[model samples]
Target: MTTETPTPLVDFTAAAAEARAIADAAGVVITAVDEVTAARRVNQLAERVWGPGVGTAVDLVTALAHAGGVALLAAQGTAGEPATDVGFALGFLGWSDGLHLHSHQVGVAPEHRSRGVGLALKLAQRAVCLEHGVRLMRWTFDPLLAPNAHFNLARLGASGTAFLPDFYGQMADSINAGDRSDRLEISWRLDRALPSKRPAAPQANESLVLEADSRGWPHPTGEPLGPGCAVEIPGNYSELRQLADPRAPAWRQAVGETLAGAFAAGLTVAEFRNSRYLLAAPHRP
Candidate 1:
């Protein structure tokens, strides 16, 4: 008889527990937002993260939660310490043929950012997905946002494959106002290990196709395109917005065109380094 290989076993139970412990250590408790009061807190949290007119209604949140979606909130300073809601996430099940989840929104309170609240919420989302037999999670984020790019692609092990231009038209929120809702659609495989970091791409003298000028406006740097290119973005676009820079629109168009052109030519984004997107051309067979 031919020898058979045994399947490797995974300890998801321990994994879930470990995720919970991480949130606890961060002084935040991640839990399902089922109660009416808790749902209201999430609504308020949405406002805090995105500004006025962006928060979901309590009724809608409750409806989605009752329909078995992943609606969770992060609260600071757990038991007997006068806790408060600092972050929240709203997501729903995907109806695709394969098991999938679509994370619609995840936001952390401004004061509570950089405190592991967002990471905690994501880990909790993974646990909920596993319970529902979902193996794939999809989400969309603005491609110009550097921190978000790093978080989704590097920290959370998500990969982006598609670029959507003006996906939501003009958003009313303060954060997205005066900007096109260009998004990079990303996918995360819940069954796999969290990648420590994006693997380094092959060494090359990549051309800088899109780069910021001295005033932080994006311009086409006079670099000859080769097998690869680099697209650099401002380290903080929020500050650019605050400055009301007249070149903001130009920057948007320039970056959008460069990315679209590269992607259309069958180039893929390989890694994010030094706030630059390292793009690689398709390999010949």
Candidate 2:
């Protein structure tokens, strides 16, 4: 017998009008939803894309399907079967050519996970963005989740752009009820520079520490940092991971706004030191 690669069954950028129709064509059905309610579908966008709930935590999208708000990628399992919905969308912070953000949902139905659906969907999104000339795609995820780390950094091809400890603060949801949600901000710098492939393996006992290499970390939310008594910050510092707190909205809001600000200022992450995954900044001084 011979085997051939499968093609993406649906186009996320092309399915803004009929979400359910897309699902029906994909052999996956959102049972309770029949008539299209923008509000409800928007909420689905928020929930399903919560990849961390499945150990691949991602952030909340723009909450709508405006021209650039969000989208759905659907597919059918078999002939005469309902289309299975498996993709999500993203948006730009403002009018910028190479800077934008996105959120997506990638998992097989309980019966289908461990299958290739997740990877298939991700590549589809990559196709949509690359086809449209999107230069960057960014999102947030919990770093504690190893599968996600391996997938984003290794599979789908993204890197840690920033780290937001306790990004979501706390949630009473079923998935994150008892754990502190520390997150890593990721970016797919779509260009000739970044490549999408897994590393051969974890480095062998290599010592790495991400030096401060700056005055101080940017905490634009200014949410109280006790006090600072020294000037001329050291080039190297050792700091432990951030405390996980549900009350920590500063991590996300501030980081999101400021990272967007840094990109506006022409700054990009230079590298990542593996020891603690310290996010390295461009040495533009």
Candidate 3:
């Protein structure tokens, strides 16, 4: 795959301020984790987000922090009260054509969902990367999860670059036990402005490559490759998994194959809206 031109240097001061403001608005305090105790807290938070028997070791988290990588913890509390860790983000330096940060894992506590905690953690991560002279950050996430897709592509203004099928093989975690570990790799340019707040509704002529039925079962439309198309995923994938619905696996396979094919056909994920990924033709030189 080809790489885009590097973004110009961002205003580190402004970025850090924005991160702090976001954390404050979310009623959390964001801080770097360099001590063993903080690293353990990160690991515990990860286990709670994923499941037992699955999380980065405390030693590794500390090593990454000491090595100049990002290891941040977000907690909620006030003065005179003990702060409780509610979210954490971990990443390390990477080389992809040039230097960048590969965000490994980021999670928020269950009770903190929909409270802007995840966005705050990500903006803080972006600020740390900019401070370290890195303008790009990449991460992989399950494409079937609409909330995550919106967070990465829409909220953070990242774009999906590649579709990786079964990227992690079989995961033993509670959230992904029987599901395929297919992922969409996304790239975030920290120097760029956040995406506009306008809605990303599909255009009139955009074809539907994959869509969900009324009952939420995924179906491939077999639409021909075109300059614009959209792929719809389930809005409540976790509920499907919880109920052991047979259509859950089907949605995974169908959406994965459809998106993989779209990427292979020179289509790029332009935006995600209404639980759908809108793909556009690659830009010409």
TM-score of each: 0.85, 0.51, 0.93
Against the true structure, candidate 2 has what lDDT? 0.42
Pairing residues by index, what is the TM-score of model 3?
Answer: 0.93
lDDT of 2 at 147: 56
lDDT of 2 by residue, 1-285 (tens): 999453233334442223333344444433222223533443454455443333222223323344444344333356776545543333434333345646533444344444444554444445445556664677777554445555666555566666565667875554455455556667765432223343454445422221122343423333221111111112122121223432233323434454344444444433332312322344321
Native RMSD of candidate 3 (Å): 3.5
lDDT of 2 at 245: 39
Pick the winner on TM-score between candidates 1 and 3.
3
Could you tell me which 10 consecutive residues in candidate 1 have the lowest summed lDDT? 6-15
Tens digits of per-residue lDDT, candidate 1, 1-285, equal 999453233245744876798698778888898878888898999999889878988898998888888999888774577788889999998766456788999999999888778888988888888876777788889888899888887777676656788989999897998799988777777766666554655446777888888877788987755446788877777667788876666767887887777777767675676787777664332
Compared with the true structure, what per-residue lDDT tens digits does model 3 show for residues 232-263? 89998889889989988898888888888888
RMSD of each: 5.0, 12.3, 3.5
Off by over 4 Å in 1: 1-11, 197-204, 221-228, 280-285
TM-score of candidate 1 to 2 decimals:
0.85
Which lDDT values do the candidates have, in the order given?
Answer: 0.79, 0.42, 0.88
